[model samples]
Target chain A: MNVPAATRAIVVARIRKLWPVLLVSVAAALFFGWLYQNAIAGRQAGGEVNLGAPDAWLLLPTLFTTAIAVAVAFACTSHANRDPFALVEDAAPLFGRERARANAIIPVTIALAAAAAQYAGARLSPHYATPPTFFLFNAIAAIAAMLVALSIPLRDGAARILYALLACGSTLICTVVALAVIGFTNGVAAAKAGLAYYPNFNDLWGGVAEASFAALIGFIALRQYGEALARYDPLPPANE
Target chain B: MAILEMRRASFARGRTNIVAPISLQLEEGGTLHWRCELAQAGRVLARMAAGIVKCTAGSVFIGDYDPKIQPVQVKRLVGFIPHPPPSNPFDSPQAYFAYRSDLWNLQCASAVERGMRIFLALHAQPPNLALAVSGALLHEPKLLVAENLEAELFDELANLRGAAALFATR
Candidate 1:
């Protein structure tokens, strides 16, 4: 088949194999969003909520819940990618890079979709003001989670333990970056100067910067994955 | 000219050889029934010959393409049917055939029709094996490699003139 046709086929097959798990991921993300809403429910105090800035402590639950949901969701994708019939595909007249790219479409789509779902779910909470750029941060975390998930080696003795460590490590880094970005965008300098309490933090430029950074990381990760697929041996020689 | 050739091709994991260095050739319309000392060894050797796994030493070629350097080209000319028959994930034969057609870039409807025809002809055979063989033949590959398949299947493959086959057995 032509490249486009073959790519379509691969994508269709992956979707067929992964729809159930993808659905589960979306549900899990939404569930986490619900938990975030409940975590900060006490801060509302039945008063008009300020749209300027949420306290760093209040954002903790959002970050942790979203990050954990994204990580677990993507880990399931890693398992699905290791199909037993992969040997059949390996012998096909398709480039490994092409196959990898095709295979990635579904996972990436699920990541974005699930992230959006979480954002939607979190938006329902009356505890905090939801910024328009909040979805962008969630998107970054979701992609990061996917990258960490795919980096895990399959069939290793301590794979589950390693997955947990990597998930936590990546989430921690993202959480720090997210907090810093929030501080910078919310006018940390302006707040310190005692000028405006919380200057309208609608930061288009900051959002663009965050998105560009995430896209760069995702591109590099996908390229590395494709190269690895090209040299992968589905059936290594037996030790005996 | 040989359609498939292995010059001392072997597979090794670290210091141990799984499929010992072996050489063989199969020309157009030829057949090679290679019997190995162990089932695992036969399985690995067949995969090497089919270009699904690279040989640790020496080389294997399909037509004029070296599997090590031109895996896609080699695979384009080869079809592999594994032993124990792969499980059928499709709900029906049509689904399976359509999937094969899409994967191989064949005429979708016609490929499905042809696959159904072949699948029906082997009605007495196990469903998984029949389905696998039908899928393997969908693209009309130049070479067919069977891993520990039954003899009756070979009778059917032999009837497909102009194609070469390699049957690996324990």
Candidate 2:
């Protein structure tokens, strides 16, 4: 088979294997979104609703998208890394690198699809059209997770687990720092004024955080891919 | 001219030398049995020939292509079947062969025809064994590197000595 044909076959097989997980993640997001909307509607009907902030409308979907994206990214990466055919396939000409690159595309596509669905669902209600910034940040966060997942080496159970934990923790910490800088800039009063003047500033820090995380992931993945190509063995020496 | 050649080639795994420096050459239509007491040595040799493992010292060449520099070309010229034959419980031999053929870029019709011929010739053998041997031949590789072939298959291949090169290790 030619390069394109081989790549297409590999990607199709991966998607087929991951269909169940993707389906469940999207379905769960939609279900929870529906419930959240209903809860808000009930409170508003009883005149007991205290919507804290207008941007809060975007929080539910953002969190849902991030959670789902991270979960799917982790599952896809872990499965690909541990596949029985990994070493054999990697040894094949043009197959290994193509497979690795193709694997990343699946999680990114799924994350984007999930984000779109959430945005569209939120649009159905008044005053709930999420800002474009939210969608952008969510997509970036998901892509960042996928890149981090793909950057990890395979065949080392303990190392894989540790790297995964560290990656997640670092991403979370970076995001919080970005949010704090944006939320506390020039004191809370000036931050509130800035948000009022430019509403996108409300979640601007989220986008910044995700963008930086994606850049870091991209760097790590490049290095890892280079090392993989140069190395003879997939696993490190048993001694170390 | 040798179709597969190794010059003082040695391989090390985590500072432990698996293959001591050895030089060998096999012509286009020759057979070589790499007799070694260690199964790991045989496995490493097959992988080196197939470009799956790199030689730490000296060099390896398949025809004019160096496996280290032109791995794709070298791999195309060699077919390797590791000992015990890699198998998946979920995959039938037919499905496995089909996938292998695609990966190797073999013409589907020709691969199928060759597979059938091998199957008929080895009809008395176990189905999986027959299939595994036939699957490796689907691409009509110039050199076949197998590990621990049974007597029956060895005899069958011996009859075709003039048609292709064969290498086996135990």
Candidate 3:
């Protein structure tokens, strides 16, 4: 069958939606690399890091918490909004199933779970600040949620794009907000006491606060996911 | 009365049409089949499984579930087939079933080991590979509708008679 030019266009659009996620995940990974270097090498990775860095690295898992949250939000949005395997899905193989509902809550739930795990884990293991384990866990959780949401069906071009935007943007927004709060609080000099750990666990408030938000975010996200699912339509004879 | 019913249902996306004025009905012993020579059959099947597309342009009834009013309920009765259920190469059959079973809400008493062994024995497929074909026929639902087919598949519909069920599939 001559593939419709329109189908090709949709494929391109899906790629575009996925691109930002790729870019951001890379950037976050690189930044975390620096954090690792600082913690291990006992020297700044490159230039100087501000002292009163106003960080929630103590309250949260810091780099990883932020990265995972952003990564997951983007992943779920993209998966729901795009026909990642459009050609195959359209073929209607025997006993094949397409999901009509997108579970936004799952990712958010995972995101919260990730944040909680990171916060609590980091707090418990304050000796090494880089906390690679926390970051790894968050990344895994976000990806898992995305894969699940992608199982659902989506019919609208606009809705797909919007889903991606929501997924990619929401956690980043949370991360930014967290950063802003940290900046406002300004890292207490004592916050740096865990140089062996990079960000110390002396301040346990971050883990608790971020974990709570993770729960709230997951709750709100599930509701939104369900709403999006409600909007799906498989065959569009009417619109045509 | 038909075990499954579809009224003048229509669906649209933006300005394009996806499903058009579709009306149909099925009794207990009916089998219907359709195949779209389009991109990604799995994606197409997924879209059909999701319910917001049906409109009063007519209504659809499945068992006691109404497509218009109880979409989630209809979803359970409706089994969608994706040719290839996604999977990780390293995952065991037990892990794969455990993961997807969470999504599909299959009977928990039905152990992953049992499901894997049954499909493996029936399909003669490898244990680790995730099969894309979603076996909705097994749900023994009061009503069911799905895409795609193999000539021999419905041949065994008789085995499902004990389900005392009603459903149709394409």
Candidate 4:
């Protein structure tokens, strides 16, 4: 069979198996959105509602997108790494660099889609214009999460642990940098400056930090993946 | 010409040496039954022969192609049926064989014919195991490396000994 045909078969099979999980994730996102709207509605009924900061609009959506992206990545990596059929699949003539690329498509697609939806949702919210930089940052972060998740199945023990730490550490550093730049540099006065103006300095800095971290993690994962492909021995040695 | 050759090949997992330096060669239409009590060792050997695992030291070649350096070419020349049958509950035997045929770029008609022949030859064995054997044979590989061959399948595999180099580990 042709590469395209085989890839289609594999992808179709995977989607058939994964559709339920994907549906559940979508439902979860919708549920979270509903809860957020409900909370806002309740607050508004009581009287004065402060919608100055875009933080509230950004927080839940970002969390949901990241959570979903991470989940998809983990699922895909774990399936590829731990499947009993891994040896059989790896031994096939078609199993090579192309297969790895093909395997990444689903997770990457889902992640980017979720990020886009989150961005659109945030933009439509009453409190924020949702800066382009912020949107780009969130998209990168989601992609990074997917990459990290993809790497999990490729390595084990210390290597896996190290990658996990790198992902978490980088994201944490980005958050801190974003907070320091936005919270410390601009202070409360800038935050209260409203959403009509250019994004708060902190949001832009946060975007920069997140994008840099994402790029770092993405670069490392891709390099590792390439090396793994070069080494490309799926089965373990006798003792191991 | 030798279909499979290993030159003082050694394999390590982490700090432990699994396959100590060993040299062996199997020519076309030759058979090697590497019997060992250590099932893991058998598995490692099968994987090495199939180009699924690189030898930590020395070299391994399948039909003159280095498994480590030219894995795709080497894999095309070898068929590996690993122990425990790499089960995928979601796939039926037919579907699995079809997928394998596609991966190996085999002609669908010939693959199906060969698969059926193998299945019939192992009629008494479990259906899944029979299917697995047929799947391995779909490519009509020049070398067959099977791990943990059962007593029943021995005769069937031995029949291929005259045509394709056979390597079995148990």
**Chain B TM, every candidate:** 0.93, 0.88, 0.63, 0.91
Q: Report the lDDT tens digits of candidate 4 across residue range A1-240.
A: 454755655565557555776766656655554555556556656654444434344344555666776566556553423464455667777645556555666666676766665555544555444355654555666676666666666676787666655555544444434544555445545344333222443366656765776778776766666567557556543343
Q: Per-residue lDDT for A115-212 in model 3, tens only?
A: 44544443443334544543533443344334333423342456645555554444444344333333334554333332223232222343344345
DockQ of 2: 0.27
**Each candidate's lDDT (Cα)?**
0.66, 0.61, 0.42, 0.66
> Model 1: residues >4 Å from true position, as ranges?
A1-3, A42-85, A126-132, A151-202, A236-240, B160-162
Sort order, lDDT high to low: 1, 4, 2, 3
Name the top TM-score candidate. 1
Candidate 3: stretches off by over 4 Å: A1-49, A53-67, A70-218, A230-240, B34-57, B83-134, B150-170
| Candidate 2 residue pairs in backbone clash | A1-B105
Q: TM-score of the candidate numbered 3?
A: 0.53
| Candidate 4: regions farther than 4 A off | A1-3, A36-60, A76-84, A113-140, A165-220, A236-240, B88-91, B160-162
Every candidate's DockQ is 0.47, 0.27, 0.08, 0.52
The better candidate by DockQ, 1 or 2, is 1
Instruction: Report chain A TM-scores, every model.
Output: 0.70, 0.63, 0.41, 0.60
Tens-digit lDDT track for model 1 on B51-76? 87789999888897988789888887
Higher-DockQ candidate of 2 and 3:
2
Model 2, B11-45: lDDT tens digits are: 88668888888789989978887776567777677
Cα miss at A77, model 2 (Å)? 8.7
Highest DockQ scorer: 4
TM-score for each prediction?
Answer: 0.82, 0.69, 0.53, 0.77
